[model samples]
Target: MTESDLIAALEDAGVHVVFLPYPKPGSYWHAHQLIVIDARLSSRWQRCTLAHEAVHAWYGHEGPCAPETEAWVDERAAGLLVTEQAYARAEWLHGPDVHAIADELDVTPWVIEAFQRTLRRVA
Candidate 1:
């Protein structure tokens, strides 16, 4: 979903979302019961960040403190914003370039890179 659609979904789910001048794209501020997204980030990055934080919200908190948790969450977030099947289609159309794939997917290169890593592992 797009950034606005994700925000609306989060709100409808009783999750508070706020955009402010933060350095990072997103953070799940459990103490405040809200998700904070960087207002300065591009819409695509914002959407990806929301997707990431939304997973945390879905689980009611961050996962257990383990090194793999973040990586797992990253993969899930990327897949959430751009489904694996959609990424495959975009990859076919865009070739095997991370920047190009990210551009096509409307996400940051970092997320694309993470998704690519997952693809490599699965292949």
Candidate 2:
């Protein structure tokens, strides 16, 4: 889904999204049902961050997540943002370069990495 679609989904789920000058790329406050994205990030980063935070909200995380939770969130968010078909097509076109694949898919390298992890788990 697009950034707008993600925002709409969050709103529909009673979560609010806001852009602020945050130190981190994005954060989800479960208690407040709010997602805050660092206003300074580029659009690509913002979109990726939004997806990551949305997964946290979907899972109803209360505070800071543990490493395992963060990993799961990354995988889930990567799945939400990039489909397997698209990833495969990007890889076919761009080879195994993470940056090239990410550029082709219009997602962050982190998302690409997470997607790779997901693919590994499935395989």
Root-mean-square deviation of each candidate, in angstroms?
A: 2.4, 0.8
lDDT, candidate 1, 1-123, per-residue tens: 777777787788788999899987778866566899999987777888888888777666753446577677788777777778879888999898889988987888878877887888889
Query: Which residue runs of candidate 1 sit more than 4 Å off their true CA positions?
Result: 62-66, 120-123
- Estimated TM-score for each candidate: 0.83, 0.96
Can you give the lDDT of residue 86 in candidate 1? 77
Best by lDDT: 2
**Candidate 1, lDDT over the whole model:** 0.80
Report model 2's TM-score to 2 decimal places: 0.96
Q: Identify the leading candidate in terms of TM-score.
A: 2
